[model samples]
Target: MSALKESQHLKIPLKDIEIATNNFQHCIGIGGYGNVYKGELLIHGKSTIVAVKRLNEQFGQGLKEFLTEIQLLSGQNHPNLISLLGYCDEGKEKIIVYEYAANGSLDQYLRRGSNVPALTWMERLIICVDAARGLNHLHHEVGKHQTIIHRDIKSSNILIDNNWVAKISDLGLSKLGLSGLNRSAVISRVCGTPGYCEPEYFSTGIVTKESDVYSFGIVLFEVLCGKLCCTVDHDGFQLSATVVKDYYKKKKVSEIVDPILKEQMSSELIRDFSKIAYRCLHEDRDQRPPMTLVVKKLERLLAIQDVLLKAAESTLSDVIKPAHPLVREGGNASEIPLDISVLSNMRDFVKYNRLKQFALRALASTLDEDELWHLKDQFYAIDVDKNGAISLEEMRDAFAKDLPWKLKETRVLEILKAIDSNADGLVDFTDFVAATLNVYQLEGQDSERWQILSQAAFEKFDVDRDGYITPEDIRMHTGLKGSIDLLLKEADIDKDCKISLSDFCRLLGT
Candidate 1:
């Protein structure tokens, strides 16, 4: 037996398991190790559904493998990882219980003749990104000095939760990295499913984190092509081989993408996604990008797709009649022309909800006169040429020294464009004040003025209509130069890297 102690709290008595599972009346799935049954257990006076996997006594998993899974699951906690509720080990019976996934495994959806509804390109991308994040966490964030590799990372192992969140399940083949141990390659017996296994690991019986990356690449392509990794073509080439061959032949990405995605997916997105998958499938293990990089690239792709989707929506909205007045015409509000230029900027207007405006006012109220004066001085410092307005070069140069996170040139331009709302390519003191009003003092009597200022501030920072201010959103839309991590540390109460409206209000002592 392993030295790891069994978690008593997570140990469910076999009698309780049998009762919860109704004497194993509902077998939902069968795997190489056991049969999974749907069950319900009462906890803290409340009943919750769960998946109970009972090992087949005749040909079940060995004790060591069972222990390894228990040890791994007992300590692991992530939104994208399957949660182990408890386990049952009584006499000759061995079983494990997991938080039930309502939508089942991803493989069921990817199968050729499956009856499940087709997933859109965006949905597929989101699922893949979610799975990559989970795998990245496993491979890098397990402990301060330890890394874990999910040796079997295929479609069936990725379970979809009720909220469409993809969770990495089935850790039976996982290998934990020991501190100070050589992780260049693990000399283990050949394991993992065919087609998904890394070529190097298969031939040499050596495994590494890169092996998981290789398998993920196969899974990625399977998601893209809507076929299993092992599915063979008429000419006998496996799916991966066929796709790679077609890619080298300069076949258009649209031609290679699954037909179901043709209507909704853009060629640009397919091309970029295909490029990432191709790199992950590199024959040389060293050529495959790490999971962290994979996550980053996927996030960028998703962000781009989101922007494109929004642009398309905005365009469609323009063609349709306005459900509500496009411009609020009242005491001080002007009836702005509903032209193409104005329609194109609808994303900016949609971001300024009442809650965000209130939060901005609350934030502004926290600043004293001295702090407000200091902010003005800081803005003047950026107007280096002593001109009345700050140009893009001035903003970029100022941010280069002041910001903890480096801003790309495009991001700098985006920020400038957000602040310079007049389309004059210059940000005057008025624009500066409008953008940073959330950090300036607001007089008690200036309620109406504060409302206007708050609206401007809300529109300036909340670039996305997600009702939260993320560091990335700030970097893309704000001229404020500071450590984003430090900013998030101060304002993101949930530590989700985004400041919610309530959190923003709370941070301002409102």
Candidate 2:
């Protein structure tokens, strides 16, 4: 009590907390600390909502944790971490207050009950990313001057704000790690929610930052599988770490994923995320990547040849069309003429949607020798400097003789924007090949080689194999940015925000 009072913590009177929580009538939950209530406080004449946790003596075990929580968290500040506001220690009443999390605890949402909205694969990843960030800060930069191990890292402790951002909460069981190191401390007792605790930590009573890593790995699997750890199946088959390890070892981890989330996840996203997550649960604690490496791996898991994770989260498009997709006039394969003029190709290129550009960009990177025969010559012809990349000057000079009208400077930049992969100033081979590839050719479709190349290109771009090409899909598998809206505006004819194989054929046929 003296320690709390001497510090700058807001020491609210018991009467105020009682009034704020309507005389303890608004009990919202039974927390690890005690009964939790939702309430509003008058701060500077404004009614600010807060969560009030009043310690129950019958539980009688958390007085140490209550003080430790106050001591460790009073000076901490992080967006991913929950903030402590005030405390009440008047007589037997020991209460702690926190900022309200509108979305409630994550455990309620994981099961996807009738009342709660299902979390998408992307949302789950973002939440894990948030939790990881919080863990990283706790491990390295806590104001407590100690390496912290959040002994009770669990999904229930992860609170989601109204904005859908996740914040780590409930530090009552957290322990100070080694004096100068973030490694193992051979404590006399084992603590933590059983299923989430690491075998090494539990068996040997040794705890470290890696112990928290092990717990977080359980949370990751919870996000992936949408279940509480060690849950028993209908047949009483327990989905324990051993079960998960077996599934992982057999490469059948997907079989256990929550059915609701299964469709939302792309196969590659699942594979990469699972690999990183399972590594966190390694039996050898030394093998687990530190929180920093975990963050980096999670963030970088989905970047492409520049369809950014940011773009998938927010920005861009991918599409592959044959340089010469044959026009079927009376369905004849040999009679249709292939487009050969750069001016005509450039003019048609202007007609493309961002989705189309995205697909072709990915396609260009993987195009076969047969597909590139004509476009390859055109690329070399424009590369007079022989630098293997096309400068804006090369572009202007190549079409300088052919355009019946003066090429608008904007048109040149637009062409570059159309083909620009990675957003670098000059057009590389991939960009140039993608842009000049004619979208109009009917005779080429009958060629087994062209058909196979087309199929192969689609497979390359659609890394998730979801059939439809979405902005998120392109963002994850391919790498391009800027002008996604412009691309979709023209290319996504149905306005469904994704592209399909028939859509590709239909647009090229036009």
Candidate 3:
């Protein structure tokens, strides 16, 4: 028996499908295979919305495509891939159910329409990252023996959920890629949408994972240009051709970027994203990067974009003023004291006390608005050399007068190690702000916001996804080598040698 037959439990009754979909009353989408209807089902006593795709009667490749999709999607699962809830095959009727995506397809959002607003650069980056992760999983992480090539990868095939999470959909056109087999399968007829299809695949019926990479590159350009792959500008040039021409001709990023994004996005970010997209679109399939490398590049771009967004939203006044003035009215006004005010209110003190017990380096990475403002002058003062970053020597020299005793080189190194998240041996503005906020600003007054920030921070250190964090995990993420034991002991309320999410939240006084 095949894997599909073995997984019989995934089959849904025809009656159930009919009832869930209200007898196909609500048609939400139309695809080449069939019409997608919005449906609702009760599972675990909670209502869950789903998309039901009932195969079109007139569709020529009906049964073959349906079974192929079932075989492929049922065996694989990834956060970025559309989950195959179940399927129904009753006599001549066939239907497949999927998790409902509230935001619908990316193509809808990318194209200009009165119903949808233009997607911001951050949203586009996030959606692209999500899609890239799905493709990477399909190409590399599916299994050692098998690779799946999404033959018809296009903007319309990528669905966006309510939370802006993009899921790759439509596996009917996917081809199973068996490694070591030189000729996986040769198709007599060329498949896939034009413009996004790999040129080599069209010329020669040879399809590989690189083919998907080519489609993904087109999607990237679509995201950047906010135009379709086949779309030709007033000058009669395709989107890809126009972008490449503009890039090589030394056109400014503002010239190539979507007009809507030009004002909001930084030039450097646009250039970097364009370079990656261009590399993916390389004529030589061998020169194109694998999905793993593509994912890494997108992740880096996302990080830089995040920092730029945060910095843009912040100003100096947002930093909380210290209760005791850091600068005196004397000639040494340039020197700002480093002492953070201890909360006198019992509630606030309790919050601070709990927060101080954990390794705060990870939490420090996400500084609130006030913290960002507070670090501006402090960062400038500490970065005495004005080298754009604070080295160990600069840090120690800045605190030389504040310490009762002489600052030790080892102590300065410890400070640097804690805030230098990238292990670059220096603290940048973001790291500096995060460290200062983690040390001084985090308190019980804004318990709700602090809770959210602290939880995110906890998740950052809890790398294993076991809902509990250990000393080793803390040490690995925060570079708190010797201090992990102390943190574990303080935060590990149940003494299980691990910190549960609840324990972590409580420890932050949230």
Candidate 4:
């Protein structure tokens, strides 16, 4: 009987990752979820900056959750949801590439005070609305499938980009069900950030949409107060237990408002938010409003705020000619294209074009040329040690002997596996020759087998048409399975932030 096999996933090679990240030198942040590093990935010859979330090698959550999470996230598309690019599913090494958010986590602004001066109240209110909309999409806007519940909702889980748009991140501990009520309910080993967890779920094992509301309530309180939930009175009153508890009790709204806001906040807005917060913290799970209601209310609030702000701005400003040439009133930023001629001389481009043309011409030159087989031999002539064997070890030594860093043994093994057809331990001269010949002379065979599967996976994962897979895409496509990052790392042959056609073929292989 055949043993059950894990589904194959796309992987990013490690070498490409090294070049993009400058050897992981520009890591901007680290968290319980994972270490986040900065990198640039090339998609269709265009370089785009991305954030690389590297799951901790030793974290059990990292090992169990990387792939499942990526697949789920990849298939989902909503204005509220973060976009998943393509992904890399190498063997045993997992990494997720994402669109970099320059403004970083909401927690950073709230806790660090570094960018706090810039976060106006209007921006904060908008952030809350944006977050609620994303949650609403997960709960109701997604296609005819089960609803999703973000088990962990906290300030840190919300990310902001350069434009100050808020997005929910870290789907590692989420669950699937319509309002957390379904026959096919999903339950995991109890996991969630403390203080944000619902008391019922924390005490019992049952997870429900009410649990998510409880967490969202915590986030709402945090956003209003700019404070973290603490067990002890590190700041004052331990907001999680005191004000949060009081709000739950008799709607003691004023007690829970962040003391830091003293006189700066609007009383009416605070009162409105306080009422919503109380509703969110309802003791009876059934009484709590769904994400849909929450999102709708938040949108109405934002609309009112926008009208008021625009009217206020209109009164203070006088029209003047635009000072910044590139700052069009309603246009988006354009990409500054890199000229390829900068890297190649006229002679090189001509030589490259000529070789490609010659290759194409050779394909139709002769239908039955023994020259195809001979050319295969020329490709494998690197086995000059005369061992009649092209061991992966031999290949690695040949290629990396002059390089500065240690070449990974696993990568060489993957390359060997690609060339070795019979699951053989070694790649003999014949095997290498056959592999080379297949690439050049096997055009006669129908290309549909590889092309169709490849295109499907690419289209499924490449949401941005950037021609590169990202962790977000992997999660969306795989139905929100966790451990996607780990799977990508294992499948990545070269440690690059991409899974090429060659890598895709390996995953598709039986």
Candidate 5:
């Protein structure tokens, strides 16, 4: 038993746990040590939610776990760790209470055939770093505490919260490893899940920080590949370990990545992680990088990708403003001919909403004070309640009635937030004007700026299509000036009845 377990004063009542689990009715899942019941508990004198793991009395091994739980988590406090708030030991019945993770186990999100949106490479790195930090705390960070090792580290043992933060869980099979301990401590217990088990432990049942490192590496591999570490032959009986090992050596690493993720993924990340997995699974065991180094490498990858992530957050219209070379005539102009060959790649447009935002920003940059102030006035005039803050519904109504800003809810929200300099939760006259001027400037910029502006304009108008840009089509979508005459006057070049692709390109400076 752990030393901390010996000093606890609170023992949760069995009846309460039973009631929370609906008399053990739901039976959401079963595990090696016990069956987990999805239940709620009032935490810290406030009504709170939590997932209850009821230890199965039927399993002989569960009895040992019951005791170990008390010992391992008696008074430990770590954010990355699943909190063991309390436990119940009623007669032969035993249950461990854990902080409720709304997102459930990491396996559910990373396992093969999971339909959930695949986590980006950056997200995987984040999860790994968090898990490593948790282990680091257990191993050394916690002040003056003996290092602890989680023997059964795997994807299933990593839980995620509603916000997708990862938490290390299931400490039943953990071991304590500290300095001055028996040099042969690891060699004493050869216990852990097979696929994730450290090879060194098999040779000499001695466990150490490296053992946890090896297990974490396997979990990381499982997450990347989205496959079970151990699996049976497809449409056949289970395959042997020898066969799996041989396959690992013979097959190309890319072939093993989950098919769902293979289509759109970072090949560099996959290859790098594969090499890391190979290091962890090395037969020599001594060749693997330390957990700290592994974490550092992953952090470096995240740092390098921060800009790309931020760039994905905006749209093109947010960047560009279509310029009316002439004022509106209140009538439709001759239709512009579609020059299909001159179309910019539409696929790139859908890839990042941020481009549109950048274009809108560029457009704002090109606008003169008069145009900017006029747009701001339009926004304020349309703001009926004068709350200075705009909602999606209000923005929608404005476009439909041609009252002020004609932008989609998403676009409107983006503009409002951008100009609301004070961030007092509202867009005042200054904000409205600033946003308008921004659009105008984007239209008047050089080619590079126009490219960005064009992307944004297409995005704002291409509400249904994925790519391609049409001047008249956009005018109809935004209903900005109603008739194509005003739009053509804004977009037309060389005094033609219709707008040409080259002329449009000139207008956009693309």
Candidate 6:
């Protein structure tokens, strides 16, 4: 685009596209710009599979966009961003060819009741991270001084390759910010998908990286909740982002999310994942974290889930079998050794169900302060991020205000046994940790009352199965006063001392 000589190299002969597409006999998809066809083209000397988009001027105002796409993609190249191999500007025929996505667009799989297998929680997290990284490159690292804004960011535009790596595609609406990436630039007109676009960018003609952040946020929720942001009702009325925002703010998102997802993931992972997505939708764009920060948080979350999964598959006996009465640092007292089953379940943590959480709290209380304090340092040292998640200070503030409501993993006691070589009760943090469990195992001795039980992750880790979760049960389950208060307040919403599944799911956002 900058030089005619350089641009001419990307020109593909019309005959090649015709040969690749079998004379335009099979159409894979239809779009605003034109019809998308799947085909194979021989480049240099070898044949390569590709997706071909042919320009249909009478179909939509794509002439300008098509030229813009060729201009922009002609200069950009990244793994996460789609690659534009070449273009065909032979007379009236205008077409672009790029690598084919075997898995198709992400939206096809995200829609509910679809025939495609649902993506696991881990897969969704990875896809989001990939998409975020691509956007980050576009917003910050594309050129020495240039910043590009992806004017149209949505679920459908994200393509998943055969390996399931997400790729950001369709940048026809993208803009090259004349100003640096650090600042927002004014645009002549507002354009983008309605529900995915930000209010500020839509109302004012000012566009920034934050605008893409907003749209990406909506996509994140769509991935998490497994539903589109803008859904048409029977009356053709579209439910905007505000409705989703209201659902999140009210903690009623659990009712709308895929119950299977909530049931499969831990409450801690769900809360933390949702928190990042929610911040991106903040009314004040400045409050939204930069793409780099979002990438860090999301990657961290994904890592935590991966670790938790590995540990869940391991047993306490599989690792080190420490003797009972494990003394605390600088304090020696003969006490009952922690239940091995409880320790085993701790490894699984959020990988299975929230039941792991109940077992965690129960172990804390069953073992006196002396025993619990022994693992405090190891617990806080799970990651170098101080709290391994949202800032510890920010996390404490959230729990303080939304107490008993957002008692996140900050208090969940992520355990890895940090096994010290000195035979002392201490953690080393990087000792090749690995463990797992069936999660559905027998409990402690009959009279022991504190054994870990293999139960539901989302709910019902009924250590004491009278079919009800009471104050005594709560106190014994999770020892922290904050968690006890949050769970009790949330569970016993009727104040009748009864825990309602509905009320608890609302608080968990699972």
Top lDDT model: 3
Cα lDDT listed for each candidate: 0.69, 0.71, 0.72, 0.58, 0.57, 0.64
Query: Which 10 consecutive residues of model 6 have the lowest summed lDDT?
Result: 432-441
lDDT of 2 by residue, 1-510 (tens): 554866444788899999999899988889766998999987657788999998987776679778878876777889899888888888888999888899988888875343788787777877888889999888877755567788989999999988988899888887867534445667786778889998887778878998888888888888888777776655565656777778877888888888887766556456667777788889988677778767755654322212223334532222111233334457332233333344445555666665566666655666668767666565666677778888888777654433232367778777766666677778888777777664323113344555555666666656788887777666666556644666555546678987776565444433
Alpha carbon lDDT of residue 220, candidate 3? 91
Q: lDDT tens digits, residues 1-510, model 5? A: 444356355467888887777887776678887788777666678766667777777787787766766676775788778888778777777778777777777777765466777776667767877887777666665445466777888888888877878888888888665632323244465778887886668777878777777777777766666665676436442322333335456646676666666754455445555655655666655555566556655554454344234434544222111222322234211112111110111111222233232333334444456545434434543565667665545544554333212235665555445544565656555434334432223332344655664554445445556454355555555344544554455445445645444444443322
- Which residue ranges in model 1 land beyond 4 Å of their true spot? 2-4, 179-182, 233-238, 241-251, 316-510
Which 10-residue window in model 2 sums to the lowest lDDT? 315-324
Better of 1 and 3 by lDDT: 3
Model 5, global lDDT? 0.57
Writing each residue's lDDT as its tens digit, candidate 3 over 324-365 gives: 234533533246544322111111222333234233545666
The alpha-carbon RMSD values of the candidates against the true structure, listed in the order shown, are 15.8, 15.5, 15.1, 26.1, 19.2, 16.1
Best to worst by TM-score, what's the order?
A: 3, 6, 1, 2, 4, 5
* Candidate 1: pairs in clash: none
Better candidate by TM-score, 1 or 3: 3
Of the candidates numbered 2 and 4, which has the greater lDDT value?
Answer: 2
Question: What global local distance difference test value does model 4 have?
Answer: 0.58
What are the runs in model 5 whose C-alpha is more than 4 Å off? 1-7, 115-117, 143-145, 180-184, 187-189, 233-251, 311-510
Question: Which digits, one per residue and each the tens of the lDDT, describe model 4 over residues 134-186?
Answer: 88887776667577777878888888877888888777677767533333344
Between the candidate structures 2 and 3, which one is better when assessed by lDDT? 3
Q: Per-residue lDDT for 358 in model 1?
A: 34
Clashes of each: 0, 20, 1, 67, 33, 17
Residue 72, candidate 5: C-alpha displacement in angstroms: 1.9
